[model samples]
Target: MDFFNDHKKLFSSALAFFLCLTLVICILPALDNQRVIQPLPNAKHLTAQETRGKLIYIREGCVACHTQQVRNIDMDQVFGSRPSLSADYALNKRMSFLQNTATLMGSERTGPDLTNIGARQPSKEWQFTHLYNPRAVVPASIMPSFKWMFIEKEQLGPNDIEVSVPDEFKKGVKGKIVASQDAKDLVAYLLSLKQVELPSNIPVREFLYKSEKKEAANSGKGGNLPDGAALYTANCVACHQASGEGLPGAFPPLKGSSVVLGDDLELYITIIMKGYNARVPEYGVMPPVGTTANFKPEEVAAIMNHERTSWGNNAKEVTAEEVKAIMDKIK
Candidate 1:
C-alpha cells in the first residue's frame, strides 16, 4: 500500500518490466523451437517457376479460401496422407526471412486443403478448367472464376503450349484458351504443393478406421477383403456422389451407366489407371483420380465392385489379381 501511494511510477515500471519478462520467457522458447525444426526427408526447395507461382498464389488471395495445412486432429486427414508437421513449412520459414512475410498457411477452408493437392489432383487440364470457371467443372462449387489468367487466341504459334478447356466452360470464345504465364506459374506452384513423406515414427494416422475394422471383422471369410463401399465413399463419393449420380453436364453419372455395368473390365481398369479426357462433349473430362489418389490395385478393385453393386446396378466382383494383371498389361 505504501509503495503504491509513495512510488506509483516505480511500481508501474516494475509491473511492466515483469510482464515483458514473462512474454520473453514464453515467446522466445517457441521461436527457438521453430528454428530447430528440420525439413522432411522428401521436402525440397521450390523451383524458380514454383516460387513465381507462389507469389501469384499470394497475389490472387487464394489463401483466403484455401488452406495449405493438414492438422493432426479433426477432419484434416481426408485432405492429406498424414498430419502436417513443423518440418513441412521449414522451407517457407527460410524463404520468409528474405521475403519479409512468414507463410500463407490459410485460416479458412472454404476450398479443399492444398497440402496434398499435387498428389490428389495433378491433372493440368482439370486445374486449368477449374481456374477458368469453378462451376463449369464442379457444378456446385462456389469458387470464383480466374478467367483473366487465360486469354483466347485464334491460333497457336509453334512455340505456344496449348491449354485444354472444355467447350462448355469456354463462354462462346471462338479460339483456344491459352494460359498466360501467370496461369502457368500458378499451376506450377499448385503442382508443387505435395506433402513430404514423414519418418516411420511419425506415421500418418489411419483416417479410414471403419474400413479397417470392417476388413478385420471379415478376415475369417477372406484375407481382408477390401471394403468396396467404404473405399468408394472415401474416394469416389466426391465426384460421383453418394447416390452414384454425378452432377449433370459437369460429371457423368455412374448410376446405371454402361461403363459401370460393362463387361469389358479392362476398359474400366485402363480408364481408372489413365484418365479420361473429354470422351463425351456434354461432360467434363475425368482426371486421373485413381492415380493422383494413389489407389492400389486391390483398392481399385474394391471401388469398382462398390460402383457396380450400389445404385441398383449388379455386376461381377473384380479381384485384386485381375486388377493387377490389367494394370501391368497397360503399363
Candidate 2:
C-alpha cells in the first residue's frame, strides 16, 4: 500500500515488469527461432539491380496488393510447388541501418502471390509490357497502369530496350514505349522471387485441406480427362484473352492462328515447351509456360484440345499418348 502511494516507485516497477514479460514472451522466442531456422542452401542473394528493384517495389507499395508468401493450404499450391517454410525468408537482409527488413508477406491478395513468379513467368518482355499497362496483357485486370515507369521515344537509342504496347492502351501516344532504368530494376527484382527446391534430407510439407473435387481432377480418376478450360485459365488466359483474341501488335491472336489449326503437332508441342522468340518487335517473347508449370502429357493434350476447339477453330484434338510421345522426343 505504501509502495503504491509512491508514484515514481510504482511506475518503475511497472516498467520493469513489462520489460521482463517482453523478454520472456517475444525476444526469447525470436532469438530461439533465429538460431534454429537457416536459409535454404540453394537460395541466392539479390544482385545489385535486383536490390534497386526491391527498393522501387517498396517505394511503389507493391506489397499492398501482392504478397510474397505462400500459405500452407491447397489454394496456395498454385503459387508455389510446396508450402512456405521459415527458411524461405531466412536469407532476407535489412535494407540498411535506418530501414529494417520486411518479409513483404502482405495481408491482402488483390493480385496473385509472387512467391514463385520468377519461375512461373520469366519473360522480361512480357514483364515490361505488363508493367507499362496491365490491361494490355490482362484485359480484365483491375491493376493500375505503371505508365510513368516507361518513356515515349520518337526514335530509339542504340542501346534502348523497346516495349511493344497495344494501340488501344497507349493513351494516344505515338512514340515507341521504352522501359526506364527504374522499370528494368523493378522487373529484375520481381524476376528474382523464385522458390528454391528444398534439400532431399528434409521432409517436404504438404498443403492441407485439399478438396476432394480438386484431388479427383488432379489424379484423373474415373477415366475423366484433365480440365482444359481451367488449365488455360491458370496459365494462358493472362496474355491471350478469354476470347482467344490476343492484343494486336503485342501478342499474337490464337483465334484462327495457323499454328493452332495446323496438323503440325510436333511444332505446336515444341513451341509450348521451348517457347517462341523469333516474333520479337511484333509480339513479346512467350515464356515457357509448359516447362515452368511442369505440365503433364494429359495436361498438354487438354490445353491443345481446348485451344483447338474453342473460338470457332475446329482443329483435330490431340491425345495424351500423342502428346507424351512428342514430349519425350522433344525433351
Candidate 3:
C-alpha cells in the first residue's frame, strides 16, 4: 500500500509505456509474416490442388486420427514406415531463423503417419476412387471422403479456356465435359508419399507392402506344367480315385466329363473361377478363390490348362497373359 501510494504517478507512466512497446515492437511484427508454414521433405513443390488439400487436411483435423512418422524401435513396422527428420521435409524457404520464430509445428500422431502413403499405394485411380468412396475397397476404413475436392475444371484453349474430355476416358467417363482437379491434386500429393528412408530390415521384394519401383507382373505367358499323367496325379488324384472312379455322391468322375472337352472355353474358365459345387450336385462345390487373387495368375492358369488337357480330355492350353487380361476385368 505504501509503495503504490508513494509511486502512483511513476507506476502509471511505466504501465502505459509497456503497452505501447508491446503493440509497436512485438505484436505489429507478427502481422507482416503471418503464420510461417514449413512442409515435410519431398512436398516442397506442391500442385495447386495439393496445396489446397493441405489446408483442408489441417482444417478438417485429419491429423487427429493419423500420424506421419514411425520410430525405428517401435512395433508399428507392420503398418508403417520409419521415423522422419525435419531435414526430410521440403522447406519453402531456408529456416536458419527458427531461433527467432514461433512456428506452427505440432507433434501428435493419432493415426498412421502419411509420410509414406503416396508411395505405398501406387494406383492413383484406386486412391481417387477410395477417396470418393472408401467403403468400396476397404470394407473397414475410418477415413472420410473429401468429395468436394473433385469439382469440375477447365483447360486453356487457343482463344480462351474451353472444357473438354480426353479420348481415353471418353467411353466411360459418363460424358462429363470437365475433369476433376481435386482428383489430380490428391493424386499428386499421394504420389509424393515416397519413403526415401526405408530401413534395412524391410525386404527388397514385396507386392503388397513396401515402396519401390515395380514392373507389372506378367500374367499372359504360357506355363511349364508336368506331363498329362503327372499333372492328373498331382491335381486330380484326391477327388477322382486312381482307378478313374470318382467318389460316389462326394466327387464326380472326370473320366467322362463333357465340359472338359466343351466348345466354350468360357464355360471351362467359369467353372474354374466359380468352383463346381452345385452344378455337379453329386460332388461338393468347387471353391471360388481366384488364382490371380491369392496366387500368381500363371500358377492357376497352368493348373487349369493342365486339367482341361488331361484324363483322356484334350482342350486348349491357356496362357498367363490371357488369364491376366481376364482377371483385369474380373478384379
Candidate 4:
C-alpha cells in the first residue's frame, strides 16, 4: 500500500510518456512526410482570366454543391476520362501566408462533378445563361440562379457581350440580361476545369458493376461489333444522355439528329475527328469525341454503326476500313 502511494505520480507520468511516444513514433512521420508532387503531362498553369475566375469560384462557394474529383470507383464512371490525380490540382497554390488557401475538391456532390466539365460543356454562352438562371436552361435544375452576377440592359450594344436568354425564360423582363465581368470570370474559371492529357502512369481501368455488366452483355458485342453500346455509355452517355435525347438547348439530341442519320459518313467522321463548336450562342460545344476518348478506327466504326442503327433511325452501317480511310485522309 505504501509502495503504491509512493509511485502513483510516477506511474501516471510514465503512462503519459508512453502515449506521447506512441504518437511520435506512429503519427508524426505520416503527418510530416510530404507526398511527391508531379505535374500532369498536359497540365497548364491558370491564365490571368482563369485565375480571377478561380478566385470568384472560391468566393461564391460553388464548391459547396459541386465536386472537382473523379474518384476511381464505379460510381464515378461519368466523371472524366480517368480518375483525378493530385497533379491535377498541384498548380493551385497560395499567394501568401495571410491570404485564404483552399483546395476546391468539395466534399459533397449536390450538383454534378465539375472536374471535366470544360471538356463536356465548353459553351460560354450556355455557361452565362445557366448562371443567370439555371431553371431557364434546365427546367428541372435545383441550382439557385446567380442573377446577381448580371444586369438588365435596355438593349445590347454592339460592344456588349450578350446573354442569350430564350423567349420562355424571359417571362416578364423587357430588357436583356447582360452578364457582368464577374459572371464572365466565373464562367472562364468553370471552362478551365477540363482535365488535360493524363500522365501515362495513371491510366483508367474500367470497373463494371452487376447491372452495368448485364447492360454490357445485352449490348450485343458477341459478333464483329466492337461493343458500341458500351463505348457510347463510357464516352457519350454523359453529354448525350442514355436515351440519346440530350439536354434541351444544351447538348443536341442524337435520336433524330441529321448528323447521326445523314448519308455523309465523311462529315460525321470529320466532326468526330475534329471537335465541333456550334457557336450558336445557345448550344454547348462538342469536344472531339473520338480523340478525347482515344478511340481507334474499329471503335469509331462500331460507334457509328450503333448510332446509325439504334433510336428508330435506319442508316448504313459503317465499317472499320472506311473509318480508317477517313481517319488517314484527315491526317
* TM-score winner: 2
Model 1 segments more than 4 A misplaced: 1-31, 94-99, 159-166, 203-267, 274-291, 307-315, 327-331
Give the lDDT of residue 329 in candidate 2: 99
User: In model 4, how large is the Cα lDDT of residue 84?
Assistant: 80
Whole-model Cα lDDT per candidate?
0.76, 0.87, 0.50, 0.76
Clashes of 1: 0
Clashes (candidate 3): 21
Worst 10 residues of 3 by lDDT: 160-169
Per-prediction TM-score: 0.74, 0.89, 0.38, 0.72
Clashes found in each candidate (C-alpha, N, C closer than 3 A): 0, 0, 21, 0
Writing each residue's lDDT as its tens digit, candidate 4 over 1-331 gives 6657778877987899999998999777644532566566688888898889988887898989999998878778577877787678777777568774546899999999999988766667668878978876566789998989988889787756777665676777788777888998899889888888855677655544514343322233223656788788766765566778866655677888899999887889988767787787656566676775567888888778777778886777777878889899886
Model 4 score (lDDT)? 0.76
Could you tell which candidate, 1 or 4, scores higher by TM-score? 1
- Candidate 1 scores a C-alpha RMSD against the true structure in Å of 5.1
Candidate 3 deviant stretches above 4 angstroms: 1-44, 47-49, 79-81, 90-111, 151-179, 198-331
Cα lDDT of model 2 by residue, 1-331, tens digit: 9999999999999999999999999999988998999999999989999999999999999999999989989999899999899999998877888887558888899999999998877778778989998878876789998999999999999878899788777777978999999999999999999999999998899999997765224322213458888888878877777889987878788899999999999999988888888556778888788997789988888888889989999977778888899999999
On the 0 to 100 scale, the lDDT of residue 249 in model 2 is 78
